[model samples]
Target: MLSNRYFTNGIDIYFDNVCGSMLDAVLNMTNHGRIAVCGMVSQQRLSQPEGIYNLFNLVIKSITMKGFLQSGYLHLFPMFLEDVVRFYKQGKIIYLEDVNEGLESSPIAFAGLFSGRNLGKQVICVARE
Candidate 1:
């Protein structure tokens, strides 16, 4: 779900609609509120077409939106690795992966990612890298 709210400076935020509509959640925001964009559930193909995002609200709010991914910070991989390891060792982190053996299953594994069929990360194990 996507929503818009106005603070001192109007900033709009889009929330994942897994549990409820993000659009409804942000309508009551005050001034100078901040929004962090992580993922989009409105992109899903569901029984109903999701509501359109209010671009006008964003423009009026002067909202600042930002997104981040691991690949974008490849240079900081070492630091990320260390932080992740500590969290993992503390049992504060969990991961899921779908591993397919043999090169023959590579295509299937790749397809899973595009289809969102794989429960977690999809990995293909080839005899050679």
Candidate 2:
């Protein structure tokens, strides 16, 4: 549960419900970073949400940011898969995951996810595919 993970390694990819962290992530990103805005969880509750002032960082740093949800893009799944598969084959994309073994580890893995301990997409391997 280290808060400084991004601050230390810098954010190559970022997404947050709140814009404040998004700004921080923008600043913390390495060169050629990407930001994918999935949802704004906290802002949904807040009447006055935060605003990001330093968007120029994206331009200066050559960062890319896009906001979208999977459900909204369900129709484009085939296209997405084709592109992703090609990218993967070309080694243009890197995937990261924190995989935990056993069904018993799920609770801990789930907890780590919320606590920010997981480094990437967290998964509990109840069985092999």
* Each prediction's RMSD to truth: 10.7, 5.2
Once model 2 is optimally superposed onto the true structure by TM-score, how far is the C-alpha of residue 74 displaced, in angstroms? 2.6
Name the TM-score of candidate 1. 0.40
lDDT of each: 0.53, 0.68
For model 1, how does the per-residue alpha-carbon lDDT over 19-120 read when each residue is reduced to its tens digit?
Answer: 124443454344444455555444454566556354354456565445555367799989989999999999976545778999999887776554345544
Per-structure clash totals for the candidates: 6, 0
TM-score list, all predictions? 0.40, 0.57
Candidate 2 clashes between residue pairs 3 or more apart in a chain or in different chains: none
Assess the local accuracy of residue 39 in candidate 2 as a C-alpha lDDT between 0 and 100. Answer: 69
- Candidate topping lDDT: 2
Per-residue alpha-carbon lDDT of model 2 for 17-119, expressed as tens digits?
Answer: 3345444545546779888877664355556766666677888989888888769989999999999999999998765688999999999887665444566
Clash pairs, candidate 1, are 7-30, 7-31, 7-32, 8-31, 8-32, 10-61
